[model samples]
Target: MAGKQVMLVGVDDSERSFYALQWTLDHFFHSPSASPFKLVVVHAKSIPISAISLGGPGAVDILSLVEKDLKSTAERVTEKTKEACKKKGVEVEVDVTEGDARNVMCDAVEKHHASVLVLGSHGYGVFKRAVLGSVSDYCSHHAHCSVMIVKKPMAKN
Candidate 1:
């Protein structure tokens, strides 16, 4: 365990995130003479407060439905990611925490004592990027360890 490094990778249902995980596995975990490491897959799920608050008398029902949906989605995505890693013969720890994506990922890195954190950029335009903010960008600066943001390749047409 002395030389084992912990690698934290943020994953979701997005193609970009899946690609990032694949990239990490191919580039690092599958490399010859690669250092010993544990892959920690982190997925953040925020409560659907906005959806609940918008409804009037049916807020409770809306909250329940939204919560269920989000949980199922998160679980499905994490399972899929885990299965893919297993197929590659790489073991990973899956973390699904409820909080802001940026904060949750950063906290995961520190809590797990990861030496490196990897993410995938969504390639959002300026307007959307400014409006929604960038989780990867925020994590890159705020994470306790080194950060890697994998950019998705352009589609060849």
Candidate 2:
């Protein structure tokens, strides 16, 4: 990609994600050779499950509480992302949307015309990934742009 292409990184409240973001910044943005990509950080704030119901009078209250918590977590993630970018002296565009991570990221790539979509991998095994559905996997296949999955290094014993 050339002429100030857009590079998007999908982040969550996970260390693996932050590590990937930092790595991208260090390798590409913080390098002496200025990258031609404009960075965009995206966080998918999950919508509260309407299907989750206690079937009691307090069910509404419980749902409201859950929504509030989700909102707070989204805010925290955004703030942390901002701090990370600031520390690197890199300006970025941050977008927070509500939906499944895979869809949100794919949509973001299209929305920004991102040349590359970077995501941190959870490294789930075959069975686990099949059960939980890996966001990175889905994005790699479904996204309109190039997808980069950053795997976290295993800790040395």
Output the number of the lDDT-best candidate.
Answer: 2
**Residue 123 local lDDT, model 2:** 79
lDDT of 1 by residue, 1-157 (tens): 4568899999877999999999998888784245478888999987798886675788888888999999998989888888888877788889999989999999999899999999999998889988999999899889989999999899999
At residue 15, candidate 1 shows an lDDT of: 92
Q: Lowest summed lDDT over 10 consecutive residues: which window, candidate 1?
A: 28-37
- Candidate of highest TM-score: 2
> In model 1, which regions exceed 4 Å deviation?
1-3, 31-34
Q: Can you write out model 2's per-residue Cα lDDT over 24-129, one digit (the tens) per residue?
A: 9988887524778889999999987773646867788888898898889899999999999888888888999999999999999999999999999987999999
TM of each candidate vs. truth? 0.92, 0.94
RMSD of 2: 2.0
List where candidate 2 sits over 4 angstroms from the true fold.
50-52
Q: Any residue pairs clashing in model 2, and if so which?
A: none
Q: Model 2, 19: alpha-carbon shift in Å? A: 0.9
